[model samples]
Target: MSTADTTQSAVVAKLSGLDRFLPVWIAAAMVVGLLAGRWVPGLEGALNAVAIDGISLPIALGLLVMMYPVLAKVRYDRLDTVTGDRKLLLSSLVLNWLFGPALMFALAWLLLPDLPEYRTGLIIVGLARCIAMVVIWNDLACGDREAAAVLVALNSVFQVIMFGALGWFYLSVLPGWLGLPQTDLAVSGWQITANVLVFLGIPLVAGYLTRRLGERAKGRDWYEARFLPKIGPVALYGLLFTIVILFALQGEQITSRPLDVVRIALPLLAYFAIMWAVSYAVGKAAGLNYARTTTLAFTAAGNNFELAIAVAIATFGAASGQALAGVVGPLIEVPVLVALVYVSLALRRRFTASTTEAS
Candidate 1:
């Protein structure tokens, strides 16, 4: 390898350890957000004041900044290989769509039947897969960056297409299995498409363009060394502030319905545990390496809360129980995934030892 390749590898190695703590910081931000929401209700309106053309500027900016590096790293040419890993892809698809959702629905019903609003919220949270944050987790787990990029891209597309269908199925079809009333869950496809385009699509294009331009002017090594790291913290802090605002806006609901938060936690925790195990097992059975397995496991476990939250607000009002359920997803997800990263590292070492001994 060239000196630049060696340096970049070293940087990625150092970053692997630091990346594990990001979720902790994100969790801490959520707590701070809740406290801020409770203590200072006025900040919500102040945050709203800085809106841009009807969208929350801070939230939009946060998502854009957070997604830049993620999109930049995507190797579009490798997407073809996704079909080559048909077994892995099929396993993920079934787990994400069929098994994962069924388990979440059952758990939500078992845990929050009395609270229909929260039940709907949990369903919404479960139907969506991770779009933004999973990229970071995949990197930390030393996952297959190419497969991850392809999955991320594919999941984004699937989310837009399957969201309303899966959502309707959850609200209408699944509830009947549990003897719950069939309610029509309304979601505006156009509005959701718009939000996805603005928040996710635009940033993704911008990141791709920026990376391409930078490579032409300065070289890939220069871009990686000088530009990427500088923007890393901006994305982190942007997400932090957005969480603060979200909590601030929903502070009253959170405070009034404290028990409801606990109610949502059980199903979410169960969903993560079950899905993580299933993904890991499937990856191993498919003969994937540790890196790709970690990617698959995390991709299955994480929820795309940004889309869920936006849909919750659009479908059920900003302070609706559904929206709150979406918010609670990340609150639980961040910490659990962080712990799982450590678990993944342990598994990697064990697998390596076994392989070496066998060799």
Candidate 2:
């Protein structure tokens, strides 16, 4: 075979390996964390103690590492291109900021109203728009990487502001509307701002600088082909590390109330499915290219659970049911989104077939 065919074959094999090993790695992380939590109970506390303003310093660092590589792919210079596709940009903004939160509120309120802490946790997760994991999902679906990066950066900024304001409003003052007692939580805007900056601002700056400096020193082709491919997996590793830490920290609660995890996941699972369908349909109707459509769908459907857990722990105690709910968010997220990855791939084939026929 020609070198071209050989290279294509190699690339296919690599992707297949990734899909096969992805679940294995996730399961290994889960087992290690669970075993550590069960056996070495002191370890979780040791990690948790090195905290600042309700955010664990170690986990915060892990999140920064997870985020930077994803952001580095943005080609900050081409962010203007996202503006050229106003339909996708506007559609994502409307759905993420408006419809998404309202839908979560309705579901959490309708389904988990009796359990206020879990309900509050769900609301917090809803308010925290995803900035990191959506890239992975979009990539899995063969979506526009550039568009996903720009939307993530945009969502990161918007969520930093909206999370605190909306969180305080929905979780605190709005209880009067529901005739429920105000959640006895004091949310400091400054603390939430600090968490957002630590988690998002640091990585965003680092990612842009890494791309620019690498390109200046090594050229664009080397930066993309050599440097990015090496660092890209860091995001997934960091994510698994964060998950382990979260699970370890809350092992007792997780072990004791298995059903509570399920309860929290139910609304979230529904939210993911419904949000994906709506955003996908809207994007298709608006005539977005398949890449932009899938990016919008995954971005709209994803939640920034890291920020949710931070804000929850800061406002409520770490062991609070609200915090437990935040922990469960990631537990349910992995398997559910993994399934969606396959679904997205399957749908893409149909989408491509239809577009080809039309052309």
Candidate 3:
């Protein structure tokens, strides 16, 4: 068998039940949520009844559950190693922070100019960088695992620091400067910070502490091989749970406005394609090996949708269009990124052949 074929089989072997059919699970969750919201009496009211300072308690729990396991998987100790690689580090920062967000902003406006709520939501999605699933994509495509880990950690720190400021700029300030219509989000930087703190901060700190303690007590092998597998599935469960609740809250809007869902999806589809393609080209030009190039591409292309969804629902109510836009994010991202994984592997074979010829 070709090396690519072997790698593909290995990836398939590694996929857990939750990870293998994530798109299917997400679709099912959306359907279940829509049905419950539409048919079940008082389901929406019951979900909305318990709020933690205007955020639904059930949703908040789901967000925390989704975020914790993924963050906990990050290798916080390896940051120094990746940071020392200036080319990889700088290229990643530029692609993720600068190029990724700007591209999404342009796409959101260019595509959904009339739909302000969904537009704002897409822009918000842009600012939230990837911290979770890039690891899986990277591994599946035979990318650099350590690079993915360190990069995810870097993105997490930047996420805490930069998300609110960027949100304010993209949503409020930048539009006014450019004569585009401003978002009606009505949120301050501090409010965004507070919401991020409650949603992202709590889980981030918890994940870090869990990793630190787990490694110290049981050693890295046990923590990774034994403990991580135990907690790993929780992230998907939490994601599906959150999606169900989100759709349940906004089912009427989503089911009724199918076209709007398509509208929200276009920019997302464009964003992933452009970001991955550009990052891959850049990685190749910068003299990266195929593995590191793949790592850079996936990391650059992916967004922290979990964070995006949490921020959207927190700032705008669960039923808001902004939240709906966020909900549609994973629905599009899961399938698209999965396709990119195959693309990356196919390119890997060509990449290997060319390198072999050159050497």
- Counted clashes in each candidate structure: 1, 0, 1
Q: Identify the superior model by lDDT, candidate 1 or candidate 2.
A: 2
Candidate 2 collision pairs: none
Instruction: Write model 2 residue lDDT over 5-40, tens digit each, in one string.
Output: 454345446675555467777777777777777789
lDDT of each: 0.76, 0.79, 0.81
Stretches of model 2 off by over 4 angstroms after superposition: 1-16, 172-175, 178-185
- Looking at model 3, report the run of 10 residues with the lowest lDDT sum: 184-193
> What overall lDDT, based on C-alpha atoms, would model 1 receive against the true structure?
0.76
Query: TM-score for every candidate vs. truth?
Result: 0.86, 0.89, 0.79
Highest lDDT, which number?
3
Model 1 lowest lDDT segment of ten: 2-11
lDDT of 1 by residue, 17-36 (tens): 33646766767787887888
Best by TM-score: 2
The regions of model 1 sitting more than 4 angstroms off are 1-13, 16-24, 50-55, 357-359
Put down candidate 3 lDDT per residue, 1-359, tens digits, no spaces.
Answer: 97656655676677777777776887899889888888888888899899765567888798789778877876778767767878998999999998999999999999998888899889988998877566657765778766876776677777767877788788889999999877645434554444556666687789889999999999999999999899888877887897788778767767787888999999999999999999999999998989889999999999877567667877787677888898788768876987888788678777766666787
Task: Order candidates by lDDT, high to low.
Answer: 3, 2, 1
lDDT of 3: 0.81
